[model samples]
Target: MTTPVEPPVPPADTAPPRPGRKLGPIADGVGSVHRAWLEPLRHTYLTSGLTLSDLSIRVPLAKSKISELLRGCGLYPRWEIMHSLSIQLQLPSWPLHRLWRQAAFEAQKSSEWVERSGDKAAVTTSLVPPLDHRAFRETVESDYSLYAQVFLDDDQRDTAVSNAFDILWLRWNEALASPDIRRFAWEALRATVMARTPHIDGRPEFGAAAFDTVALQHLTTETERMDQMAESLHLFKAMSWLPDRQLDVMVMRRLYGTSPEAVSDLLGLSLATVRSDERHANHFLQSVICPTPETEGKTA
Candidate 1:
């Protein structure tokens, strides 16, 4: 009780340009799978939908080649692979086109999330105002560091981090909260990342694929859920109660490990003032606002 992808014909207007150009087999609707094909193909056939029965007889490729190409493999054929399949099946092109677009969108997002993190410096730009520039860099850096440590070797770390990035970026809200901002970041990030890592697939380790996949999926899921529960902007306002200078002091000394002189130069404060401010911020966070959790079972 299922339907299959409809066949597609070349758009009517498709033609070779100019005199002596000669009519060409237009390739429109060639490479992409049509959306009408999604359910039946995915549910029943997977890559096996292109069976070379009498129905598949007229497709350009031989039965064996057709079978090989059914999954939409490594390289896209110069001709419309999907279009031929559609013709063989005698299905309409509309649904197949829709499915192809959907798959393209998903593949784009997946590439963005899993493939870009090998270059940690690429993520530093701020998209808008009211951004906690420090926290953003630190958080992304921490994620990168965690990934680097997870593998500990050059090839493993590089591949795993790249894959992890693509996996994370596809979820949208992990980087930007607003939908428009998310779209913009996703597009820009996708283009740049894909350019940088042309051959990345974002599958870190065969053994940990399931864990890594679920981890990133739920990481963003929880972030969105928690952002809602905590009321993001409201929480931001509440956190702003900490004086900017004290927050700066705590961040430099504790979070950054910057020396007092470096802190003084960065914050435009004197050495004495930097030391005093650090002491004050540390004392306040330790006692009033933030307390260190017990490290009994935690690493040093």
Candidate 2:
């Protein structure tokens, strides 16, 4: 006779919400490290499709520790915490070790949390604050999986893609990993940062989020300008697929919004060459984007 495996479930009333309380040694370790400690943990339990109770039963760490970490505990992840977490996650020990080491390194580097305020966020703060615990877990795994796809070893990217869940993540992986793709991750991330700036701490306030009338209208106008700029980047990414001269024109115009004369001068091309390139780009976009039922069009 054998015992049937039980389904995982969230614990009821985990450890009375230990917020504002002083923590122990392991908790202290977690506090001193990167916010990404949960990245590995998320991959472990959340990605593996297990719940808190399931893991606590396997690992020695209390369910509360896991819950607290996910729910915004101030501690960074510890090796023992990771070991127990990986065991509960049922990952191979070797891969789990890599993840553990990577978590420690990444947490130390902590680039993602360099928000506009540039405040060194303690483990108590999140980089993207809009994310809830569940949402945050999904974002970390998804974003890092994209990073893995872009920068990871071939075997790593393939494995990550096989495990990834959505189009956003899929595109991100493709954007980051493919050498032919030209590192759009930095551009997109830069745009995201630019978009965030006006609404952020250092920039002049413009909107009702600032709770001002004319300020809000100015905010609206600035926001719309940013949206157009952001939308234009997607168009430029597509144009990069065209011939190099054409790509240059489109990038100068759309990506940076530079003038044709400016682009020609920069590339040492004649004005005619730049104009011709622009015309070629427009023709390609029209043929592909404005295709009719009678005509076949390629996806950008």
Among all candidates shown, the one with the greatest TM-score: 2
TM-score of each: 0.23, 0.28
List, residue by residue over 214-272, the lDDT tens digit for candidate 1: 22444557766554444423322222344555654544454345677655544445567
- lDDT winner: 2
lDDT of each model, Cα atoms only?
0.38, 0.42
Regions more than 4 Å wrong, model 1: 1-50, 53-56, 78-80, 98-300
After superposition, the stretches of candidate 2 with alpha carbons farther than 4 Å from their true spots are 1-40, 47-50, 109-300
Cα TM-score of candidate 2: 0.28
RMSD of each: 21.6, 19.4
